[model samples]
Structure formats: C-alpha cells, structure tokens
Target: MPFPIIRLDYMQISIEKLSHAYGSVEVLNDINLTFEPGEIAVIIGPSGCGKSTLLRLMGGLEEPSKGAAYIAGQAPEGSLNPLTYIFQDFALLPWRTVAGNISLVLEDHKLSKQQSKAIIDDVLARTNLSEFHDALPHQLSGGMKQRVAIARALAVSPAFLLMDEPLSALDSQTRELLMDDLVALWSREAFSACYVTHNLAEAVRLGHKVIVLSRRPGKVREVVEISIPLNERRERAAELEEVQQQLWHMMREEALAADRELADV
Candidate 1:
C-alpha cells in the first residue's frame, strides 16, 4: 500500500521588518511579507540583492541584523525538519547511493530503520525515482540528480522548502522538465515553500505570489499575484506570459543599474 498523504497544518511564514547586513554591507532591508501554507512564494531580483540571504533568514540558517523572519503555527506531525533546503548544487554525497543519501538526513532524527526505509521508499516513489534507488549521483543526469535532492527534501516532510535556485544549474530543457515534475508533485501533496530564483519564467510558472525585490539593500518592491491555478498554468500560458512580462518591466531598469554597479565594483 502507498504511504498516505499526511494532512499538514496551517503554517504561515511572515517576514517582519527583516533586515540583514554582512559587515557594513546591507543586503536586505525591512522586507515584510507573508505567505500561507500550500503556496509557493518566489523571490526574484537582480543578482547581489540577497534573495538567498532572505531564504536563509526564513529557514533560521542566519540571524538577521535587524527585524525577524518567523513562522507562525505548528509543523505537521512527524516532520523531521519543519524547514528544509534544496540548493542549486544538488548537494548529495558523491559516494552514497540514492537511498543512502536520503537515509543520511533521517539518521539525525533517530527514526527506526523501518521508518527510515518507509520514508525513503515513499518519497522516491513520489518523485519517480523508485527504479533508481541504488544509483549513485554520478550515474544520474543533471535532472535526475536534482530529483534525488528533491526526494531527499521530501523525506524530511518539510513544512516549508527553502529552495535557492534549485534548477538554475540545469540546462534549459532539464529545467523545464523539473518544473513540470514540481507542479505534479505539488498536485499530489500540497507543500509550501519560499523559492528563490532569478528567472522570471520560473517565477511566473511556479510562484503563486511572486515577490519582486529591488537592487542591493533589497526591499520588497512589488508583489505580483497570479490568480491562475497551478494545474491550469500550462493551458493558461499566455496569461502567465503577460504576467511574466509585467514582472520583467518592473525589474528591467533596476536590473540594468544593478548590473552596471557590479561591473564597476
């Protein structure tokens, strides 16, 4: 029998006047926003705008210099990690088998062997990695390695996924395929996440609410809402295209200026 989809609680992530700085350099400033459970909040901005830093703050991986990034409400029962990260570089151990890579995360939770195996099996099946269970990271393509990283994230039963350019490393074709996989996975078991990406298409395709940030000392410049349902986004691609274009227009000038500033530095 398949492992049943666990009912998750109503968790809400809120960023309240959140500011952060590295030495004297301020990266993010007073970034306040809120996203509820079952929604994907995509953060997009020019490079050096601290999108990843905001994600780290959300996940409590770093302490902000000022303000707060906090979650309200309980994580689902049996969640080993309430907040999990899926990084751009599929950070799997080079030597571990697919199953072993997943098992590593569970080890710290002290789950019984049976529980660990069950979690691993369930996530692998959900991610369509069942047949590749014993494969090493090197044996898989770029997309498949990412799929394993995703499956590993799922094994922890995350309340919120802090994805930092999770698909940016893949070629265009592979990235497209992975986006489809993500939408399909979301359809099965609704999950919440703060996804950081520089790609506007990715922001439009995956984000329920796309939060656009300004250049350095990044602040919430705009929050563009997509009313289309996730399952219908493909058929409604034209509409999403317009929204994507709108986002591009909003970021274009700042992006250019941000680029020039980097060039000078």
Candidate 2:
C-alpha cells in the first residue's frame, strides 16, 4: 500500500492588530488573523475593503500603518523561499519564453546553468506547461499564461503562496478549471496560503478556512472552516452553497452600507 506522502516542515503566519492607511484614509482596521501551516486561509470582503492591501502587507511588500505581519518558521521539505505572490495580471514578460520567464526568478539565486534548467523543468512539469516551455506569452491562451505565472512562482519553491484574485482575468470556464487545479496543487504540495478575493464561490471552493472582512476600514467579520476534504468538495458543492450564501449575506450588508456612504456624500 502507498502511504500518503507528507512534508514535515511548514510556515506559520500571524497578523496582529493589523491596520493600513493611505495618507489620511484608513483601508484596513485591526485585522487579526492567523494561518497555520498546510492550511489555505482565504480573505474576502466588499469592494474597498482592502483585501489586496492585506495580502501585500502579509507579503511584506507594504508597510502597515499599525500592527505587524510575521512569517517565522521552517518551510516544507522542498521549499526554499519565504513567500510568493500570484497576481491577477499574469505578470509574464512578453519577450521571454515560458522557460525564460521561470528562469527570470532564479537569476538572482546564482544557480549554475544546469541547476537553473532542472528547476525550470520541474516547475514546467508541475504546471503542465512542459510542451509550452519554449513558447512566448502572446502565443498562449489566458489559462496558459496564468499557468506560466504559477510555474514561475513554484520554481522558487515558496513556503507560503499569496494569491490576489488570481483567476479574475480568466474566462468563466478557464477560471473554474483553474480553481480545481489550484485546490489539487495545494493539497499535493501542502503549502500554507492566504488567497484574497471578492468571489464567495471561489472562497468556498478553495479555502480550508475562510476569513470574512467587513466594509471600509476592514475588520475581521468571521472565519468559516470547511471540514470536507478537497477531493470531496466538487461532489459536495450543493452542501457548501449554504456556507457561500452565509458569507454573501454578511458581505451584502457591508456593501449596502458602502452604497449608503456614497449616497450621503
């Protein structure tokens, strides 16, 4: 019998009393959350609720006006980097081939040519982009482009993956497929992740624990934990719809309040 392979090490992330402001305006407020290793904790809220801003803060790309984000732990068995972000834009260089785009990330690592080739090949195979390794961005479809982005991120072997509405730009069909692929990838790799999105369906489908935020000056509203395994989520879609609706109702109230704020002005 084949035992389930497990990676011993993992990263633990914590956000304590986190708050962010732009000049005089506050975007996030006292958002306290924690992501345990091997868990997919997704954050979702109404527009202007600073979902993306929180992700950036967690990645240490932006300085928080208050509180702090911490990432201090050992990575999984094969991972090397601390964290990696997968953006919605599929930020691939047009002039670079798929393999080259992946190689771009490894350039600063000072890896030998053979070492670079090995890493690129591994990620290409992981993302199912092996055949498109030499292809340019313009030649690939939207889904393929995102795959390359994911491959590039994977090549770095990040312990934590931060995604900001990564499937927002793709068509519906492509988005659905990618969602499934993402869950499968996470389940297999067991990397800690904090995915940010406004889509509740996406949240319910991908999150092991979903963190809901309130409107403007975002606050922690609720955290929903899904007990169903990843492989069972598709078959149990209807069962999960209630969780989706519950989140929608919570977010809708804030959305309406936002509309009221706009009207008051």
Q: Which predicted model would earn the best TM-score?
A: 1
How far out, in Å, is residue 142 in model 2? 1.2
TM-score of 1: 0.95
C-alpha lDDT values of all predictions: 0.91, 0.87
Give the distance in Å from residue 4's predicted Cα in candidate 2 to where it truly belongs: 26
Candidate 1 local Cα displacement, residue 183, angstroms: 0.5
In order, what is each prediction's RMSD in angstroms? 5.3, 4.8
lDDT tens digits, residue span 1-265, model 1: 4432333466678888889999888899999888778989999999989999999898988999999977778888888898999999999999999999999999998888999999999999999999999999999999999999999999998988899999999999999999999999888888998899999989999999999999998999999989898889988999999999999999998899898884321
Write model 2 residue lDDT over 1-265, tens digit each, in one string: 4433343465778888899998877889998887877888989998778899999999989999999997656676656567899999999999999999999989988789999999999999998889998999999999999999999999988888999999989998999999988988977887778899888888999899999988888899999898888778989999889889988888899988876665211
Off by over 4 Å in 1: 1-8, 263-265
* Residue pairs with backbone overlap in model 1: none
Where's the lowest-lDDT run of ten residues in candidate 2? 1-10
Candidate 2, TM-score vs. the true structure?
0.93
